[model samples]
Target: MSRSRKVTLRAHPHGPTPGWAEVDTPPPAPDSTAAAFFDVDNTMMQGASIYWFARGLAARNYFTTGDLIRFAWQQLRFRVLATERSGDMSQAREVALAFIEGWRVEDVQRLAEEIFDELMAPRIWAGTRRIAQRHLDAGERVWLVSAAPVEIGRVIAARLGLTGAMGTVAEVVDGSYTGRLVGDLMHGPAKAEAIIQLAAVEGLDLSRCTAYSDSANDLPMLSTVGRGVAINPDAVLLREARQRGWEVRDFRSGRRAVKIAVPSTAAAGLVAGAVTAGLALHRRRQRVS
Candidate 1:
């Protein structure tokens, strides 16, 4: 007999109404594999979604070239040191809102469509995509979790054909940007909470699912899954992952599934050249002697 799936929509106490569906828990299918959750930024790509936002804003002409220059400078300073300055985040929010303040929602979505193909697709990690495909091919659901605004996350979800996406919900009023976020930011524990809620609605058993990430900030969400994998994890996260016995994968090109060797492919060419030069010198010395 076929299993019935149920969906539930729950109201947000402090934010815009979020629609969610609750599923009646069902027995695992004979062919069903575990679901996989992915952290979108560093784990799946080389940088953060904010970087893409800068490009997106420029494409829409929402920001002047000068504005982009300022944004780039801030991005370089804050992210390089891995510091979360509240002032920086606030400033970022302000700039982001100003860019889309009066833009029609439809226009923004259309622009997202273009940005997804141009900026996001080619930059996505091949190993990450392979892992996502492995789960999908095994008949498991895939979710994209990020701290980016819901609208931006939705665009990425659509591009990847994912089952759903959970992200920070920026506040909007009367179909215009409100320059503030609604509810809790979808990060750390909030991310774990969202995943649990999503799983409950889909009748998914958390113990049978998997999650992948690259930072310690995602610990809560990663811990929620039965199998958590750390991909190209940061220093702190690498130690934590090892302690917790979590599966780990290196996303750099030509990197072995084991320890993160220097980014291969490009580095390999340099090594080969050095070895060839060393051999040539040794042969010349032998002939001279």
Candidate 2:
């Protein structure tokens, strides 16, 4: 289940995005028995990888501007609220799965690889990455546990040279997606369950493992490990981490209070700008056609 791939970061070909860096660490020795689990959104990267993937699809005209707007709104809520509600999860599951209903497994995988290099790679938080690298340096297996499609998670893990990844599995038949999930989304308690199952298969001891996340939704996953680190935690997770004496690492520069308050408005503005541009581009294309 865990396999290591060598990753070497080169100069950014698509210009700069925030938090990009080149790691100079030597190769890991793989001496440790314990492993580390990392949450994807906000913890490993600055934003939702799935949203970025959707944006890429939208650019390729795979979906309409309206579809992108809806996804952008959901992603904004995800970033601002930082809490995973059942309704939100259900809606996200539907939206995420519906878009790729008939996509070939290989085609989606190829797009995911392109999306990672173009959008996801630049958004990676340098601080969180350094921590992941430290675990790699110590020779412990590292896996990205995400609610995103497993294909996206695997791309990220492979790009970062992690041991592997676990994510929501979208069912496929005859090499094409069926637009349905195999089980529940790999989120909240489901994340913990996946880790527990993986541990058993990989001969890992939960008592010696560590998990990192940004949301209180992952409290189940965090508690499942011996050491839990909250990376840029939301207000709820921050409070919980303090009470539980879990390690907290905040890489954001602003005052803690500002971090919580600003995301809603800031992210909303970003989505609005994107929608405006998308609409304008759509209109132009329509006029030309």
- Each model's RMSD to truth, in Å? 18.7, 12.3
Q: Could you give candidate 2's per-residue lDDT for residues 145-262 as a string of tens digits?
A: 9987899999999999998999989899999988788888897899999999999998889999999999888999999999999998888999999999999998776674354334
Minimum summed lDDT over a 10-residue window in model 2 is located at 260-269
Q: Candidate 1 on 203-248: residue-level lDDT in tens?
A: 7889999999988889999999899999988778899999999988
Residue 241 in model 1: lDDT = 95
Residue clash pairs of candidate 1 = 7-21, 7-22, 8-20, 8-21, 8-22, 9-20, 22-201, 23-201
Off by over 4 Å in 1: 1-34, 71-99, 253-289
> Which residue pairs show collisions in model 2?
none
Per-candidate TM-scores read 0.68, 0.74
